[model samples]
Target: MILVDSSVWIDYFKGVHNAQTEHLDALLDNPEEELAVADLVVFEVLRGFSSQRTKREAQTLLLTTQVVEIGGLDNALLATEHYRLLRQKGYTIASPIDVLLASYCITHGHDLLHRDADFDVMETLRGLRTWPH
Candidate 1:
């Protein structure tokens, strides 16, 4: 399964064209590819919208993908360890949510579809797999 991160989703929703969005578009076009959205990713994407109509539309679209819960004690612990590892390596992710989400993907063996640089850093240093692999 592929975990679609909020960074890609936000840009896709706003009609911003980019390589990641383009890849997401292609994946959406292919019925064979299994895509998932983390619950925290859903929250991150939805919280950015101000329009009720747009929010509802986004929610409806997001529901079409497999929704996966991104939290639990185990996930949190792994995320903490990953965060500490990164910090020790002199890299710091700005968002706790990103760290947690990356940990979820790493543990689940799901390739992440993201546009955030933090994920790239995680991929390089922490073995966080990403889409287009």
Candidate 2:
């Protein structure tokens, strides 16, 4: 399974042309491909919805995707270690949420599809597979 990050979705929704968006679109085109999204990802991506109705619509889209909550017992220790390791390397993750998601992907053996540099750095810290789209 692949965990999609906010960057590619943002670009796709805004009609931004890039190698990343094309890659994402191609993935979506495959009939058998499965896409994954966490609950926190919806908050990050759909915060732009201006009205309650729009927010609800965006939420509906998100609910159609899979939701995985990270950092219960098995992942928290790994996440903290990832946070410290990335910080030591001087790569800014910018949020605890990112760390949680990255850790989830790492522990679950899921590849991350993202253009964000944070995930790039997290790969080194967490040994998670990343698909830079």
Most lDDT-accurate candidate: 1
TM values, all candidates: 0.97, 0.82
| Candidate 1 Cα misplacement greater than 4 A, ranges | none
- Clashing residue pairs, backbone N/CA/C < 3 A, model 2: 20-133
Query: What does candidate 1's lDDT look like per residue over 31-51, in tens digits?
Result: 999999999999999999999
- TM-score, candidate 1, is 0.97
TM value for model 2 = 0.82
lDDT of 1: 0.95
* Model 2 regions lying over 4 Å from their true place: 51-57, 71-73
Query: For residues 76-95, what per-residue lDDT tens digits would candidate 2 score against the true structure?
Result: 78888888877787776887
The true-versus-predicted C-alpha distance at residue 129 of model 1, in Å, is: 0.8
lDDT per model, in order?
A: 0.95, 0.76
